[model samples]
Target chain A: MKLTKEDIQFIDTYLENSDVVFADIRMEIVDHVASDIEDRMSASNTTDFYNVFKDYMVQNKAQLLKDNRQFLKSADMKIWKAFLKGLVSPLTPLIFLTSFFGFYFLYLNFNIETFRLIISYVPLIGLSGFLLTYVVYHKAKNLKRFSVVERLAMPFWVFYQIPNIIFNFSYQAKNLATVLWIVGIVSLVLTLMLVLVCVSIKLFKSYEKQYKTLA
Target chain B: MSNSKLYKGSLTTIILKLLNENDKMYGYEITQRVKELTKGELKITEGALYPALHKLEAEGLLDVEVAKVDNRLRKYYKLTETGTKETVNKLEELAEYIKTMQALVNPKLA
Candidate 1:
């Protein structure tokens, strides 16, 4: 009654075709279905593997897929919330405050027009390019494992860019002369904080380790 | 027997209680264990079980470990420290609710 390699393979293909994308979720479903099939086979009434699987899927597929989607969405939200929690926690305030003050100090010290111009463009351009390149490169490297959150990271970065674009376009040179220091400081703090927060969040590390063996 | 809707609300407490007793369990094992414990009057559907487990894990109440067994990867879930503490609170809450329901349903016993 144990599932053979061919049986397991067939189940794997069936799930993939059914659009169960994440390997972790797929593994759980596969195990559940396989175990259910084995149990039915041992009952001695159901002999056909395909029929058992088909019946199980017919009964459970919608709920299974819906649950998978819900779990992924909730997981993504939880990770972002955790990242925000990390940012606002007492432990990390020093890091963000330090960055904030560091940028403010740089603005006060480096008041040159060219220096202001360069600082203004550097972070906006640099961060946008870095995020784009990271997304493209990571997608290219691990296309199969590019999860919903990973794909969503691109649009999320673009959302960040909307503010940058507005700030850059709306501020005149005279306005910049008046508050370039403020602009530079705010942009630097925001950009560095975003990068730091994104890289430092380890909520998914354990899942990533488990997934390494999967897809 | 309880309504499925009523059972759904207590599913987390039920799961926590099971994990507290057993130390670890996988998806199928959990459903089977629940059925065995309930004597088949209650069945934990595949739909309900996996999402519940994942949600608890996301909430940091549970931890997951994947081990290879019989040539396939099996994901096991167990309670975390927070989950252990939460289980006690949830069980107390459920117990009080059950007592209240009993008094309402069987006034002579009260």
Candidate 2:
């Protein structure tokens, strides 16, 4: 028994009301429930979608929603693991080295005060720009909210505030060694952020591909 | 059949073994397959099944592919290269475990 569009919409509405708000996770659950209801309707020789759905929910809703709550944590773990894996990938060191040398070159050529200001502000500016672009891109593409992709952006949010925290502390490098240390740390942070952005884009594209056929 | 705990430890292996045999399977299909293969003695619930799938996916052992089927999108899980290799290892480990349990449960059979 194939479910009608209205039947699917009912399931979607029910899940949303039940707090299954993330579209990616909700899509999977909707499919699972719809499939189960179809199987029941076929076996029982009944077309009463509501009765079948209600009965199924009575037996399964608690379990399903319980598992749903864990989705965010699962997504968080997956994102962090991906980020860590990205950090250790062979390309990371190359990116780090290249950025390190590039930053160090600028440091040598540019005035020290201007160099420090650029290093401090670049991550903040870059993070804001990335967020703006990400929001607009997703809106333009009409991509659904995915928990994994949302979690992937979390580290950048934390990184975005670091410059402000340092500014508040008014910490300044006093010597070449201190300046070099700051440069190295900034290079590493930039490399990590770049890797995270790459991972985020990869994840977004994967999800986009998964749902591309949807109307 | 009443003790889900007995099967809990082997859930990952069961999933891997199934994916090893079948090219790809979705959540509902995997559960139904388990019930069918076990002659209804083992039923994999959705609560238990999705988490396992997600964990294996996180571990880089399973790859997910989504496609439009019927009126909805179906998320199918398949064994990655690492997952394929790990399935063999898990199956071997499970066999050894069954052997140990068999020896303990029925000494003469050992």
Candidate 3:
């Protein structure tokens, strides 16, 4: 049977305020209403649409366009898509900044004598800690628990690399400081990745938790 | 008319007890029956009723049959084996409490 506008109102009123029930019922209405409009067309479907569709929605005359129900999903979709796009889109530029400053300072600060002293005082053992941060942070895809290990690994970086970067590249201890300067560059790259991975994990976990609670 | 509060949490028990007495009922028919039996004192809202039916169906307490009527599909609910057992237990518990309330209220009224 073809439903009139009143028929739609009857069913909608019957469903009351249940949103999901309205969704399920309204899908059936669209199918049947379209089918009824299709069956009566000979001259033009355009001519029939006004007559058939108008009668079907005469009672929809009172409802706001938002009350149309069909547009509900589209209306609620855009804000979230933009928010998530904003969250991860800046990581590349930020990581590049870490790499540039890290490499440049190490290049500017090391000289032969202080670099030699850095070798005597700190050994290459700190490189192992920095390298561990570099490899593990990338390998894990920045999972949350990795951040705790990243924090513990950071101290070894400070002990080995940060102190060894001398301020003046023009100085006489220049050759030794230059070698130690290379270590600083490596540490800067590792440090940025280490911290970025930890920040990413916390954010990823928060997003996951938010979705779980919403569910 | 759709906004009356019946028993706070006993609607399920009431529905089970009523269905246990009869055979099966569709949503519209069940709402009609409750209104008739309760003299319009209990009106189940459609929003509340459908979700309750879905919850009972999920719990394995309600068996549902979908049938077409006059171009519209209607879902009918019946009790599962477990639901029948639950209905009997719930009715017995409610009856005992009613009897206790009657004894208390009768003397106070006297």
Q: Which candidate number has the best DockQ?
A: 2
User: What's the i-RMS for candidate 3 in angstroms?
Assistant: 12.8
lDDT of each: 0.69, 0.83, 0.50
Worst 10 residues of 3 chain A by lDDT: A74-83
Over 4 Å off in model 1, which ranges? A45-47, A88-91, A109-155, A165-204, B1-3
Q: What would the per-residue lDDT of candidate 1 be over residues A1-215, giving only the tens digit for each residue?
A: 88887788788788888787766667888888888889988886766888888887898788877766765765565555555555565545565466556655665676546544644554454356445545554464352442433534543465456545645643443554545545544554465446433543342344456666653
Cα deviation of A117, candidate 2, in Å:
2.0
Expressed as tens digits, the lDDT of each residue in A76-175 for candidate 2 is 8888888888788899999889878887888789887777777877586547646764786478887766788777667888766665554433256667
lDDT of 1 at B64: 84
**Candidate No. with top lDDT:** 2
- lDDT (C-alpha) at residue A173 in model 1: 36
DockQ for candidate 1, C-alpha atoms: 0.55
Stretches of candidate 2 above 4 Å error?
A: A106-112, A162-170
lDDT of 2 by residue, B73-102 (tens): 789999999999999999999999999999
Better of 1 and 3 by lDDT: 1
